[model samples]
Target: MAWALLLLGGLFEVGFTTCLRFVDGFRNVPWTIGFLVSVTLSMGLLEVASRSIPMGTAYAVWGGIGALGTVLVGIWWFGEPGTPVRILLILALVACIAGLKLTAGH
Candidate 1:
């Protein structure tokens, strides 16, 4: 349950970023509202999950998910360039996140 909440929080992080991107430096009222809501929800979920998950692992996983999802969305939705090196680095980040999860247990 905690991990699931953490993942949701991370996706909200991506939501926040994506909303922010559409806000034009927060000048757009609706997108700004979306960004604020997403930020609040993401932090709230992270706080809830941190109660059970180790703080370091939870934070790393949350941030990693947000970063990975945001980059992919940028490439797919916004036509951001997905250069070879960028793709490789994103894969490396995925490996690192997986490693963190695998090592989380005693």
Candidate 2:
């Protein structure tokens, strides 16, 4: 349950970041609101999930998910480059995230 919450929180982190890209320095009201809401939910979920999970492990996993998701969103939604090297690095990051989960013991 804690891991689930943490993963969900990480997804919210990606939401907030993607919203931020459209926020236009907070001048865009709707996107700004989206960013705020997502950030709130992400942090709240992270806090709750950290109750049972080790803080270090939880934070790393959350951050990894956020980074991975954001990068994918960038490529898919923003037409960002998806070069082979970049994809390989992203895959390595995924492996590292999995390794952390496997070793976290929770």
Candidate 3:
């Protein structure tokens, strides 16, 4: 359950970060609201995840998933850079996240 919360937190982290790009320097009201809500929820979920997971491992996984998801969304939806090198880096991050999860041992 805590791992699930951690993954949810990672998803929300991606949401808030992606929304930040749409905020237009904090001028877009709707995006701003989404940013705030997503950030709040992400942090809350992280807190819950911390109860059962080591802080270092949990935070690494959280950040790794958020970064990977945000970059993938940017590439797929926003026409951001999708060079092969960049894609490989993203894959590497995913691998690291998976390694952390596999070794976390609940």
Candidate 4:
């Protein structure tokens, strides 16, 4: 349950970041509201999940998920470069994130 919540929180992190791009320096009201809502939910879920998962492990996993998801979003939605090296590094990050989860003992 905690892991699930953590994952959700991480996804919300991605949501907030994606919304930020649409926020247009806080001038866009709808996207700004989305950002606020997402950030609130993300932090709330993280706080709840941290109660069961080790703080360090939880934070790293959360951050890793957010970073990975954001990068994919950038490539797919924002037309960011998807170079071979970038993909390789992303795969490496995925491996590291999985390693952390495997060793978390949760």
- Superposed by TM-score, candidate 2 places the C-alpha of residue 22 at a distance from the truth, in angstroms, of 1.1
Clashing pairs in 4: none
Model 2: residues >4 Å from true position, as ranges?
none
- Candidate 3 shows a clash count of 0
Order of models, best TM-score first: 2, 4, 3, 1
Q: Rate the local accuracy (lDDT) of all candidates.
A: 0.94, 0.96, 0.94, 0.95
Alpha carbon lDDT at 94, candidate 4: 93
lDDT of 1 at 22: 88
Stronger candidate by lDDT (2 vs 3): 2
Candidate 4, residues 1-106, lDDT tens digits: the string is 9999999999999999999999999999999999999999999999999998999999999999999999999999999999999999999999998998899885
Per-residue lDDT tens digits for candidate 1, residues 1-106, read 9989999999999999999888998899999999999999999999999898888998999999999999999999999999999999999999988988888773
Per-candidate TM-scores read 0.93, 0.97, 0.94, 0.96
RMSD of each: 1.2, 0.8, 1.0, 0.8
Q: Candidate 3: where are CA atoms >4 Å away?
A: none
Determine which window of 10 residues in candidate 4 has minimal summed lDDT: 97-106
Looking at model 2, residue 59 earns an lDDT score of: 94
Show the lowest summed lDDT stretch of 10 residues, model 2: 97-106
